[model samples]
Target: MRRLTAHERALWARVAASVKPLPGREVPKLPAVPTPAPAPAPVQPPAKAALAPGLPRRPTAPTTKPKPPHPLGASLDGSWDRQIARGRLAPDRIIDLHGHTVATAHGVLASAIVAGDGARVILVITGKGRPDRPARIRDELMHWLERPDLRPHVASLRNAHPRHGGSGAFYIILRRPK
Candidate 1:
């Protein structure tokens, strides 16, 4: 395990000190943070050879995933949107993608839609991701819905009411299976 810095240790101690233990349980001991290893000696870089005038350098990896592509499927009317936003529309089914990996969520979502049968409204919780981090589930949801497997069942995707998790969740209106 990586060692905690002096500042982190001190802060952890303060927070631990302030918390009350359960009625019969004693305060847990603090984990021992390992000290950082010594830095390696700096190595000099090899001299760079001049490149021919025209070729471009390789592109760097992207730091963040791109936002969802254009909307697809039937766009629900405004009344439907407002019904969801106001919390009046109850979902016939609900699926939570929080804490799941992309592949796992994809499988689960596919299975959910296939099994929904006659269910009309479905609530899917993708979890509002951290401001500092990318929202993998939310970002991938559009792509998932666009897939041929799940696309047929999804009539539309609408943002859930604030009470239902606001931007963290969606209302999946399904097309009635013939």
Candidate 2:
């Protein structure tokens, strides 16, 4: 393999600075390039502090609020909304994950998604939690779906209707396979 050029080494230095090394591992640093001392700039007289006549001062950037994640059904079209509202749409595949632990559920969901059988809509059932504590599986389902490989396959996620297990179930609308 050829040695990295100066440009490649410089790019690597920038990349290395941004990463967090694993425990007991150190990030390899690039050799420092010695910059030559600059020639002295000529001294100049100070100008008036007041702005030049008719020149408008630029406005400072506005502070933006962090928007919440988009609502589950927002991106879906009217037909999807109508079917979901009327509880008329039937799921093509049903993956019941009520009893599985986090790791097992994650693997199953990934495998099912990757090895899809042309399912347009999948109903995922995560059992409702006890009155005192929220269910871990239910909470983590969204997080799992957000993985890079799965997110593209999924179009939108909606809470299932009462007939379809209500809040304990989620309707995963898959994008039409191209």
Candidate 3:
């Protein structure tokens, strides 16, 4: 080996000073690391509340029984007559009249008279005839009465007075005939 110059020796000494050597027993070794596991999914609870009060708990079942039909003529009574005098009738009576057939022209004329004369409580016999075409005429008459022109004549209406046709007829009470 060649002998170093004073400048080269000083440079070598500076480089050697920065470096360190570990003793055999003082050196450290890396420890083994463990991997982490995934978390489980959440669970949901079952339904327990009632849908509505007084209603059946099961959706497939009904809560109440159906009502029986009323006896024939049972719905007709004196109060109905008073209602007729007022030119007003119940929806049930109007529905019943749907069965009768007074001539369209005659019905129109009668409606006109009822309106013009202020006739209170006129009996309209809508016969329970023609099962194939029930209540056709009565329905027509009721429709006609509802027209703006005829409305002035009618005050109120009700099912036929008990003495009247009951379900088969109607009692139309006109506004005091004008």
TM-score top scorer: 2
Give the RMSD in angstroms, all C-alphas superposed, for model 3. 29.5
Residue 63 error for model 1, in Å? Answer: 26
Q: In the order shown, what is each candidate's alpha-carbon RMSD?
A: 18.9, 19.0, 29.5
Q: If the candidates were sorted by their TM-score against the true structure, best first, what order would they fall in? A: 2, 1, 3
TM-score of each: 0.57, 0.59, 0.40
List residue ranges in candidate 1 displaced over 4 A.
1-74
- In terms of lDDT, model 2 sits at 0.84
Tens-digit per-residue lDDT, 1-178, candidate 2? 9977666776777888999999999977669844445759988979858889899987888799888856444668889978988999899888999779999998887777776689888888987898886788999988888888788787889889889999899898888888
Q: Which ten residues in a row have the lowest lDDT in candidate 2?
A: 30-39
Q: How would the candidate models be sorted by lDDT, starting from the highest?
A: 1, 2, 3
The per-residue C-alpha lDDT of model 3 at residue 83 equals: 56
- Which is the better candidate, 1 or 3, if ranked by TM-score? 1
lDDT of 3 by residue, 1-178 (tens): 9976555666666666566646664333323223334557766677777678788766566678886742222344577555565545443223233423456545544544444433444566676556686666655656666667666666554556455565666655554432
- Candidates 1 and 3, the one with greater lDDT: 1
Model 2 superposed RMSD (Cα): 19.0
Candidate 1 weakest ten by summed lDDT: 68-77
Per-candidate clashes, comma-separated: 0, 0, 16
Q: Which has the better TM-score: candidate 1, or candidate 2?
A: 2
